[model samples]
Target: MITVFAEAGYEVDRHFDDGVVMLGFDIDPTRRSQAVMEAREHRAEARSMAELLTPSSVAVIGASREWGTVGHALLEHLIDGGFTGTVYAVNPEAFELHGIISHASLTEVPEQVDLAVIAVPHEQVDAVVDDCARAGVRGLLVATAGYADDGGDGLARQRALVHKARAHGMRVVGPASLGLVNTDPAVRLNASMAPGLPERGALSLFSQSAGLGVLLYASARRRAGSACPR
Candidate 1:
């Protein structure tokens, strides 16, 4: 299947058995090589999407104390989902969240951070991206909105975001993304605002709309007999 995409001139990256595929196109021949390099990083390695999917350690850049905020909810869900890896919280003003010590910034974290789930506001995303790139973080899951979806300047910002991350050989999920979940028993990473974990299975879901993603996940969970908890 990946070959099909490559044959058709699309830069296909990943095609998993569960029906998940990642593909893109490079209009410029000069940038194709760089795109391939980026694809290799996204394939799986120390600095790649593997970390985002099955990271050794994750730092929630916008971790928060407020119960209703996306940052707090994602952190709670990630911990509650039983990810067997190190979790760090980053909040400049707070020293701790959910019982773990918090750092003032991504760079402040003592050890390397493979993936960073950013839930900060749209205005501060560039600065966070800079820190993530400087820290050599592998993948980024940006749950904040106001990017390409907003059109005009927002679209330009979104384009720049990807360009910047790609230049650093880092992968980004979304500028207005909901997040990702891997129900694999060995790596149960849930870095989103979705409440309760869906039962582990073969199904892999993706959606452009967060509202619909929630609906689909909820429905899937109910069908699997592991209904989402309120």
Candidate 2:
């Protein structure tokens, strides 16, 4: 390590005391402060990951009663996958879905939502993200498309969504994501539109395209399965 540092323009020194060895580097104050900031950001990112992967509770913003819809499939994925956490369904028009009581909005739910899955339309996405931020949702998984994929205006829309989530100290997965699935036995979470939660394995896959993700997951399952959370 001392040799590597010396090659990288750092003043490296070695010291010994009582048979103990230690290496030191002469670091500039500006670089030291920058390193501190980078460490802080990495810690924050890890916290967000923990919240997103192992939330105590979750809310599906656009959960639906209709069987063929994306919202319906996402809700079913969570329930059928044997997720142990509290699941809240949010739909303005319906009072109940799959026997669980549904709230009119994110703020209407009584419990603290650790993760919010936004499956609403592109036009309604910005408002829904704002509501989730205001309600203090720790992490977000946006399944809504049309932003960034549509080319011109979508770029700006996607940028805004990310900026808002960061401003609130929240982590956001995607503006055009398929969903997320964790096959861990302790926390079985499938917040995506994929057909089934693959069996627990060491493989972890992430992608922006739902179609390709579904294909990859199927292939992974054929070989013993994987954990894919986009």
Candidate 3:
């Protein structure tokens, strides 16, 4: 009997040959077993999310030139953090922002984009998601807050946004998220709107409450500053 299992987007086939279990393909048994364990541990949805967190290139779909907006802050953070990967700023009305070339849409950007950070108004999120999907973006970080957080009609729109992302095989981080940051020096990704960057350390923090997370980062920065010799 041959049994096939799909896990974390990977398909594994096991065959019972003469009372012995064997993998259908010519793969190292040890490696195959490890893969099976990993697959079982993570689901398909989570696998895509993992990719979203470590994208090499990111596009800011609602990037803005205005200083006070979330889109502007996020773009500034990425630049100040020294993110080594490519960054694209998308806005139909803008030609340039902070010296970076701004495209009218995601599709207009010539390079491949791995992730899209949407900071547009809630009403515009769905259309932007559609644009991102058409542009082949695999991950989405929706920083816009008006959706489900607003209740009623907003919830329905949020649902539609998620449905569209899933249909295109893309992973969404949040519709009302504080954003994300990776302290790795090589990656140097800071996708959040936090006041400042926290010092790199062994410990990593994940907070559901955006306010608390911002405060935590601020405290970390203070602690790091305090520890430094004057």
Candidate 4:
């Protein structure tokens, strides 16, 4: 897979119009698995995010008891996913969410925080980002949509945020991402639709379209079920 990516990366470098520049994964396989492992660890470190910033802790900036809200779903899903992290639901004028204590601000949290999941409205996102950065949050996942994808004013504001986040050394994944899933650690970080991924296996799937990804997952499951293994 890495070799395929390397070829794709070189191809990307040949043209300036290739959408996003592709960076090849560089890992020395000659030193055995150690080099590969270290490379992965470094990538993991840059993306350590939620786990790195919060140390078994989480702060949801838009938490609510209301059903079906992003905040609600995130909290519920994290619990169901067996996240051992402590979750702090932050909402001013609200004391609790689903029976757990809720803080009014990230600064109110007693100890250092590692992650902040933002699901607030687009207008409130900048403030949330500023708050998280001030709180020294290591990782932030923004679940709120309606950014530049909507065009017009939204695009300008989203661009401002892109600059702000880069300045703060804070990592922001999406204003439009479907989130991510790493079942290896029993972790499902994205709040998007779960594709009913396999719990244990060496299987890995990547797709640009969410619908196609799920369809392929179903096909793979069917093939694996009916075919005989060597």
Candidate 2 lDDT, 139-203, residue by residue in tens? 89988888888898999989988998889988899887787788777888988777677777777
Q: Candidate 4 on 30-71: residue-level lDDT in tens? A: 353555567778887656643542345677788877886787
Q: What does the lDDT come to for candidate 1?
A: 0.82
Point out the higher-scoring one by TM-score: 2 or 3. Answer: 2
| TM-score of each prediction | 0.76, 0.80, 0.78, 0.65
Top candidate by TM-score: 2
Model 4 / residue 200 / CA error / Å? 3.7
lDDT tens digits, residue span 28-112, model 3 = 4455567777776677756765676677998987888898999999888988878879888998999998779999988889988
2 versus 4: better lDDT goes to:
2
Off by over 4 Å in 2: 1-43, 208-212, 225-230
- lDDT, candidates in the order shown: 0.82, 0.83, 0.79, 0.65
Query: Each prediction's Cα RMSD?
Result: 11.0, 6.3, 6.5, 11.6
**lDDT order of candidates, best first?**
2, 1, 3, 4
Candidate 3, poorest ten consecutive residues by summed lDDT: 1-10
lDDT per residue (tens digit) for residues 1-230 in model 1: 65654654455555465686555556454455567667766665544445578888989989998989989988888888887788999999998899899999988899999889999998999999999999989789998889878989999999999999999988899987878888777878888777666787667777877778878887888788554321
